[model samples]
Target chain A: MQQSNVYIVTFSVILTVVLGLLLSGTSQVLGPIQKKAVELDTKKQILGAVLEASELSKMSGEEVFAYYDKRISSKVVNIKGEEVEKDEDGIAIIPENVDIGRNYKRKPEDRLYPVFMFLAENGEDVESFIIPVYGAGLWDAIWGYVALETDLTTIKGVTFAHASETPGLGARITDASVQARFQGKRIFDESGELQSVNMQKGEGRDYSDDAHKVDGLSGATITAVGVNNMLKAYMSHYSAYIQKRRSGESGGMAVLN
Target chain B: MSTETAQVTEVKKPAEALLSKRRKKLLSDPLVDDNPITIQVLGICSALAVTTQLQPTFVMALSVIFVMVFANLTISLLRNTIPSRVRIIVQLAVIASLVTLVNEVLKAFAYDMYKELSVFVGLIITNCIVMGRLEAYALGNKPYDSVLDGFGSALGYAWIILAVAFFRELWGSGSVFGVPVFDQISGLFGDDFSLATNGLMVSPVGAFIILGLIIWVQRTKTGYVEH
Candidate 1:
């Protein structure tokens, strides 16, 4: 059958309009659910950095959210460690809303850093602080949460996730064994300088004994370096806060909430 | 008249006409002889990527099946009206719409699987099998036959992926559908059955090897040779 130019044009236009409407409608209906999924996923990852993987995996969605709501408090702070106040409308500026992905584009001094405080059993004692870090891996983006101990110097735990890192190699950062190495490693040296944790190449050296070094993935040197750089860059953003906490100037972990 | 006689024959045996020998072939041929994945080697990317684990592989297969059948039926129904000059775009529009709907539904209902599959679910738009069947069978066939062909080819693609996933997940993670089978074996054998998983099985290389072997075995058994 011969199709005239007019017929083709009309048909194409109608088809495009119908398809566009269908897709947009689907997106509109599912957008909220997808947003909730994303929020839950972020909360779960934040919890994963502090809690055991097995423990985190066992919790239901409601349980994860409830735990997050009850125990974790977030605050947005400037580069100088001062809290960023709410806008003129009095709506509190939530730290969770401060996306680090976008912060990468802004100047260091202008960036608003978020700090997630994990409260202990007493609800007053700050157990650990979790910071989100992300950087480019060998292939794509690699991101993670690093939880600092109450002292604000030692690493409590960490959870690494990646976009498209090489599976069985760089992707092993997501493995529990690799992340476990960061536990108890000091982010600050003996001289009270922020060193961050380095993902060193090779094995046999005791990662636990080194205050500022963790075992890197065997075949993923570029990714390991990427992780090292990400940690250094992100952790430095909280240097003022960490220093203030270390000085005991706020009378031993003041409750921010 | 000939038209009156044709109407009488068509109405006389509707059931027989529905399940004719040719119709059966349309549904069955793609399962073996004209398999889209095994024989034609279409859509190898997702097959290799998602087969690293069974759960994601299963979800991916189902998504492909859904897209294929719906896209085929839509195209077939509009075959005559669709301008030949812009038929490919029309097919693409139908397929993309179905895929986006599937993706949204998955995000709402199966969020975990959606996250695991991630971009792969989006990549279904680019899957050759869906487009190939649309062009080769749907454009020229009736709606019912196009649906059958789409279903058959999807099955052909699915089984290969599922088989690859079975081996990969079993040996790679010592699990099936996330259940640790080897751990159970170890429990039964009282620690003597400790099995170290093959890391290669979790990588793309394992999928390549498994698919290659499957094609080889299938060809040998079917006695089909590429000339």
Candidate 2:
């Protein structure tokens, strides 16, 4: 069937309008639910760093959100270990709103780091501090939360997620069992210099005695190096806060049990 | 494939039965004889990417099937009005919209699957099976027949990826859909017995090897040879 130029132009216009309207309508309808799901997932990841994966898995979406609300308090800080109450746009900075990927692109000194404090049952003392770290993986961006014990040197736990890392290899970073290996590992050496836990190349070797090294995925050398550099860079970026807290310079230490 | 397209175009009966012999063939042909992956070899990109795990591959298959059926129907309905000069863009628009719908629904309902599949979901827009169906089968056929053809092609794509995922997961991770099948079998023996999974099966190269073997076996059985 041959069509006139007028008919073709009219058909294209109508088709474009219909498709545009259809897509926008679908997005509008599903926007809230998608946003809620994403918010819950982010909370789950942060909680996964501090709590058990099995425990987090057992809770529903509302329960997770409620648990996060009840137990977690957050504050944003700059590279100087000073609190950043607002962003450059004068919007109040919250842990939920701080984009680690965007912050990672900026200069280290200019970045705002969000610290999520996992509160104890009494809700008075902090149990572990969860910090977000972001970097490149083998194929794409990788990021995760690293939870540090009250001493601010030992790791309590960690939870990793990647955009497009190789599954069963570089993507093993997201595995809870793999993340469990970081438990009890120390980030600072005996000399008080921040070493930041390293993911050494190769897997299934004993790093139990090592203070700053963990066994890496076998076939994912680049992703392991990515994690290593990410940890080193982010830890040193937050070292000011770690050092200040370790030295009891922060007033929060006065309330420590 | 050209013969199949020619057969579709030759049928002009306005009141043909919904499940006529021709339509049924359209539905069944892609399962093995004219498969999108093994036979036609259209959508090998996602077949490799999502087949590492059974769970994500299953979800990916369903997403593609949904996108294919609807995109085919929509394009077939509009096939006459679509300007031939800009038909590719129109087909792309329809497929992209359907893919976005799938992506949104998955994000809203199955967030875990959504995260697991990630970029592969968006890549469905570029999957040649969907576009090939739109241009070849849908543009020339009735809406209902086009839907059946799309479903058949998607099913063929699905089964191949699911099969790839099955072996990949079983060997690569010693599990099936996250269940430890190999580990349990190993446990039946003494503690000395343990299955060490082959890491090669977990990578894209694994998908390549599995797909290659699948194509070889399929072609040998069907007596299909490229001249």
Best by TM-score: 2
Model 2 per-residue lDDT tens digits across residues B36-115: 99988889999988898899999999999999999999988876667777789889999999998999899999998988
Which residue pairs of candidate 1 clash?
Answer: none
Mind sharing the TM-score for model 2? 0.93
lDDT of 1 by residue, B1-227 (tens): 11111222223344557768988898788888988888999999998899988999999999999999999999878877887767788888898889889889988888878878989999999999999999887887768888999998998999899999999989888899989898888898786669888889988999999999999999999999888
Measured against the true two-chain complex, the DockQ scores of the candidates, in the order shown, are 0.48, 0.52
Top-scoring candidate (lDDT)? 2
Which regions of candidate 1 fall more than 4 Å away from where they truly are? Answer: A86-92, A248-257, B1-13, B17-21, B182-196
lDDT of 2 by residue, A1-257 (tens): 45679977998899889889998998899999999998998899899999898898999999999999989999888999988998788988777878889988889999989999999988768899999999999899999999999889899999988998887788889888889889999989889988888888788899998888899889899999999888888899999988877777355558433
TM-score of each model, in listed order: 0.90, 0.93
Interface RMSD of 2: 4.5
Can you tell me which runs of candidate 2 are displaced by over 4 Å? A249-257, B1-17
lDDT of 1: 0.85
